[model samples]
Structures are given as structure tokens and as C-alpha cells.
Target: MLRVFRHYIPGITFVVIALDVSIVSATASLAGALGSWPGGGALWPKAACLVAVVLLCLYLADLYRLERHGRRELSARLLSALLSAAVITAAIGYAVPAFRFGRLAFGQTFLLLTVALGAWRSVWVTLDPGQRLRKRVLVLGVGPDAAQIVALRATGAQPYDVLGFLDDAPEAPERVPNGCELLGKSRDLLSLVDELRPDLVLVALADMRRSFP
Candidate 1:
């Protein structure tokens, strides 16, 4: 998770934002050059400003909060953000003519940014679930203690991927929720760690007094 402005954003979402900003800025510069806007050397600053405005619009529209909105909702939000950014850009251009790229360049840049950002986000959504960037967690017990972690997962409160439980008690019933894998005894910790490669191992043993190797 990436924290910005006290808000926790998913890592993938942050990557998307970075990509969008880069693409938007590039598109703006390209549009300016194609339209033959004056001050060719100084055009980059204008392009950067345009991208900043668009990103601010997107932030206001909650585009950065990936978990809160579904694809359809996100698309609608993006459209609204683009429209808002365009309006704000037009207003700024009207008030400060020196900062304005011509109408042709502005239109081209807006259209390109909309398409680029939308396509990028579409691909991100499609691939995000299969990405291994999310932390994988291994629970070290299968008793009531471990059940709490499973409960948290069931409630969707813990975002980490669970790699399931481990226990050494041969007679202990499966106390973890159904569908969660019980990946053998505690004695197999090293081998399991090697095979699973979990980002975190949570010790929730019922008998903490027992010496664990």
C-alpha cells in the first residue's frame, strides 16, 4: 500500500497514477508540437501544467481509490473528470491567454489523454487480480487463534493474500474456515516457507508455552 495525503492507496493504483501522469504529459507535449504552438522550448512547462490539472481533476473524482469503485463506475468517473479538467483548462486559458495552448492543440491533447488513461486503467484492472504484488501471509496455527485471521479475511478487512495455516497437532480438528488450505504441520515450516515464499508469517499458536524449533 502507498500512502499519500494520509490515504492508503494500493500499490497497483499508485503505479497507474504515475503512468497516467506520464502519458498525459507526453500527449500534451505531442499535441502542442503537432499544432505548432509558439514557444516550442517552453511548451514542456505548459504540458506539465495541463497534466497536473487533469490529475487534480481525477483526484477530485476519486479516481485514485481503486477499491471503492467498480469498472463501470470508474469509467463514468473518468469521463466526468476529463470533462471537468477540460472546462477548468478552458477557463484558465481564457483568463490567461499566455498559458493557453490553441484550441486545436487543447482538443487533441484532451482526446489523447482520455483514451490513453482509459486504456491504461482498463488493462490495469484486468491484470491487477492476477498480480503477485499483494502480500502473501502464512498463519502458523489452525486453532481458534488462527480462526481470527480467517475471520478478518472473510470480513474483507485484511487485504493480504492468505497462504493458509500450519500446525503440529495430529489430533487437532480443522478450526480454520473452509476453503483455507491447511499446509501440513509446524515441523514443515522451513520447507513450506521455501515453497510458498510468503511475505509474512503470523504466529498464532494456541500453545505458545511449547518450544517451537
Candidate 2:
């Protein structure tokens, strides 16, 4: 896990960053073409600059943070970042007339890039591979100890897909948290393992003296 802006992200940050940059660059190129820029030769430098500015703004806005945000809030932040990047790009163009894409071209590029980035982020959020790839965990008890595990799962920073708990004392009252299912008894471990195929099994036995097979 890597921490960014006080939020922890999985190891797939490199891949995600690369993909985002690629998409942004591609969008900038298309924007240039739409604006009738001289050619790829003249457009790439501008695209590179745009990519840097946009990415920097995103970083500053905590867009790279792993914490969940409502879709509306996220979209609003993304738009704000893009707008800030556009302002910076305009300032740079004003300072260096040679790099200017002209008012018309610059406007077109900003508009297109905004739409492109918005679409890319929407897809990224909707298809979060990290959530899909979270390790499936199975707890081996349903008592106070197991309840702690359930609470940890609900509040911990690390992402996990819990399959549920195994109740060793089948006849005892349910102690697991609400919404948490008692998958089965310890005797059914092998069959449950075959059925759920959990990535990790956590032993949370309430009784330390009890023998575990």
C-alpha cells in the first residue's frame, strides 16, 4: 500500500497513473487536431505541458487519494482541477507567446480535455479493479473475538472481501455482527473452503484450549 494525501492506495498506483496519463495525452492530441494545430510535431509539446499541469492539479486536489467520495463531489473536484490547470496553461501561454495555441484552439482543447478527463474518471471509478481484486477473508469463529474481526473489516483502511464467519458452536446464540453471516461450523471447513475458495482463513477461536483440526 502507498499513502498519498493521507489516504492509502493499493500497489496498482503505477498502472493507474500510467493509464491516466496516457488517456490525458491522447485527449490533448485529439483536442489539438480539432483545433487545427499545424501537425503532431507542433501539438505534442503542448499536450505534454497540458498533461503535467492537469496531473499536478489533480494531485493537489487529492484526486489520487483512495478514500471514497460521493460521485457528485468527486466530479465537482475533478472539474475544479481541470479549470485550475486551464488557468495555469493560459498563464504560461501568455508569458510565452511562441507556445500559445491561440484563444480559439486553447478553448477547444480545454473543453475537449475536460470532457475526456471526466469520462475517464467515471469509468475508472465504476470499474475499480482494486475492489474486485481484494483478498477474500474467512473468519473461523463467531464470538466476541470474531466480532472484533468483523468490526475491523468495517473500519480498517485495508480493503478486504470477507466471505463470512464459521461458527464452531452451532447451537449457541449468534454473536456475529448484523449483516455478517455464519457460514458454517468448523466440521464443514473443507466443504466451505471448496465452495468459497477464500484467499485467507483467520482463526478467531473464543476458547484457546479448544482443539482445531
Candidate 3:
């Protein structure tokens, strides 16, 4: 359930915006019908602004979130938020004398917005599932730089397919043999490891390191 909610954030956001738009338009049209709205020309801009306000209000209230609340609790939160938004909308309509929107418009808009939002949430979840595979890789270097590459890969979500480490230095030899093979001389680098087909090739050598000798 937690995973499900995380995957549906985008859908929820889209729904919220759509709902706000529908509500504003309906409210403005109704106000116009009632002959209570401001000068005729200002209806659209005012409606647009009203939609913006509603969106802002939702944001402040944190209504359109996707946290993992239990089923019943989650439903309660949503219901409360919707009711709160409706009351706020009515208050705004009544207080601003210029904004004389109709109640019928508000009711219809709310229902339409509800249906649209729910449908969108369903569609978005179907399309985008979060889990994905990550390939593990082994770095074949024995220097400071090689260690850094290994570290960075570990932090990210994509799991690595690290086979092991391989040391190339000839003199000192490998100190901590981490199970990686010391595949032959560097000169045969291309031909020897062809089967590995690594997704990433990190050359972690200093200028002093000699070519395959």
C-alpha cells in the first residue's frame, strides 16, 4: 500500500489542478448568472485567479498528498480536505461582493472534479510502476580513484552486479584480494575481458602506470 501511494503522486497532482479549474469556471459562471459578479469582462481573469487561490489553498492544507495512511484513515483525510476546500470556496464567493457565483455551479463542478481526479489516479498507477533492475559491475583497479568509483555506484538505487575487484599493479601485487580475478596483462585488456561486457568501463590509473608490458 505504501509503495502504491508513492507511485501515484503525479496522478494526484494532475487531478488537483483539473479540479481547481473546473470549480473556478463553474463558480464564475454561476456568479455571472446571478448578476452579482464584477464588471462583465473581469469574469475570466477573476475565475483564473480564483482557481489559483484554490490550488494555493490545497497546497497550504497539504490536501493533495500521497502518504501511506491506512485505507479508512486515508479516505477520511480526503473527505475532510474536500469538504474544507468546498467551505473555503463558498466563503470566498460570499465575502467578495463582486464574486457572485452560483451554488449549483459549485456543486456540479465538485462532482465532475472528483470523478476526473479518481480516474486519473487509476490510470497513472497502471502506467508507472517504480521498481527496476540494476546491474552489478566490478572495477579492476588498485588505486584511490578505483575506490571512489566503487563508492559512488553503491549509493544509488540501481543495485550493482559487481563480480569483484582485479588488481593490475605488477610489483607490490594485490593487498586485499576481493575475489576479483587479475585477468592477464593490460595489453590483452580488449581480448581477455570481452565476455564480461561491462556496462561501464572505469580506467582508474595514474600517468605513471605503465602500459601492458
Candidate 4:
């Protein structure tokens, strides 16, 4: 779950705040249509306050925390936050008697809020900055450990600059399973990486002794 939250939670808060702004704006615009309660002239102020309340509630729920959660758990948390926001909004509107927000506006706000939040998440996934920052790297092995780094780069998880591989055993494949070059033997790593000046140097040699071997 930490993985999921670390990757998504801040951006989720950003999206939620955006959606809340839209919902509150919509509610304020249609306050009269919804049946304005007693102290109704200050619609915008009340709407702004409602938005603030939603944000506070989200924070209190720990919805904006950067803790990770499984996909199912994250979804449940999101759903609960949404429901809680709606309930709180309704309850406050009732108690204030001055904030006359209506049912049609409520429906519109909630529906639009969901769409806005989902869109923000989609945008975040599409525009992941790690993908944009292409860093070069050279792995020091052709074995299982090195292979995992290659897989991670290919999957767009870790931004790496894999210039190629440096295998000591000549008979060991000349190319990595993921197709980076077998630049040379393990002894040549420092020189190769120095020349490459890659953003990172991942020593994925299965045997730690082979790092300098």
C-alpha cells in the first residue's frame, strides 16, 4: 500500500481539491435554484466555506497522506471520503439554516467531483516526470540481478541509463536479456561508467565480489 500511496496520494489530494472547487462553485451558482435558506445573500462566501470544509475533512481523514495502500484499499478510502464529504456538506447545510443548497446542485456537484478526480489521476499517470527524465545507466552483470534492473527500466518504474552490460565471463551472453550491450568485463565498469557519466550506477551483479572482480 505504501507504494500505491507514495505514488498517488499527493496527486489525489490535488485532484480532490480541484473537484471540490468545481462542486462548490456549481453549488453557489445554483443556490437560488436549490431553495435558498434564510441568510442567503452571501452565497459566494458560504460556498467558499463549504469548499474549505471539504478540504479539512479530507485532511482529517488522512486521505492526503503519502502512505501506500492496495488498489482495492485506496478505492475504498476514496469512496468513503466522497461519501463523508457529501454527508458533512448536507449536515452543515441543514444546521446552518442560512446555507440553502439544493438537491439538483448536490447531484451535479458530486457527479462532477468524481469525474474531475479521476481525470487528475489519469493525467498524473500519463505525465509521470520520471519517464521524462531519461537517465543513462550501465549494469555490471548479465545475471538475474542485472536482469531485474533492465526489467524495471523497461516497465517505466525506475528511470535508468542502461548504456550496456559488463560481464566477466566471455562465454556468458554478449547481450543482456533485455538487449543492452555487453560492453566489457567487470574490471572495466569504472572506466565505462566514467566515460558514460550515467545518472546512476546499479551494481546488479548476483555476486557482490564480482562488482570489482
lDDT of each: 0.73, 0.69, 0.51, 0.60
TM-scores for every predicted model: 0.59, 0.55, 0.40, 0.43
Overall local distance difference test of candidate 1? 0.73
Per-residue CA lDDT of model 1 for 1-213, tens digit only, reads: 444663333466668678878998888778866755533336766776688889899989988755445678879999999999999988877777656777678888888888988887777667674332355788887667665676675356446767777787775555766767666678878877875567899888877778254
Clashes of each: 0, 0, 9, 8
| lDDT of each residue in 80-116, candidate 3, tens digit only | 6556667776676677645434555456545554555
Where is model 4 more than 4 Å wrong at Cα?
1-40, 65-74, 129-213
State which candidate has the highest TM-score. 1
lDDT of 3 at 88: 72
- Model 2 lDDT at residue 205: 73
Task: Tell me the RMSD of model 4 versus the true structure.
Answer: 12.5
**Which residue runs of candidate 2 sit more than 4 Å off their true CA positions?**
2-9, 38-41, 128-213
Q: Could you give me the TM-score of model 4 versus the true structure?
A: 0.43
In model 1, which regions exceed 4 Å deviation? 2-9, 36-41, 129-213
Location of the lowest summed lDDT over 10 successive residues in candidate 1: 1-10
lDDT of 2 by residue, 96-152 (tens): 655566566677777777777678777777777465446678787766676567667
- Give the range of the ten consecutive residues with the poorest summed lDDT in model 2: 1-10
All candidates: CA RMSD (Å): 11.0, 12.2, 15.4, 12.5
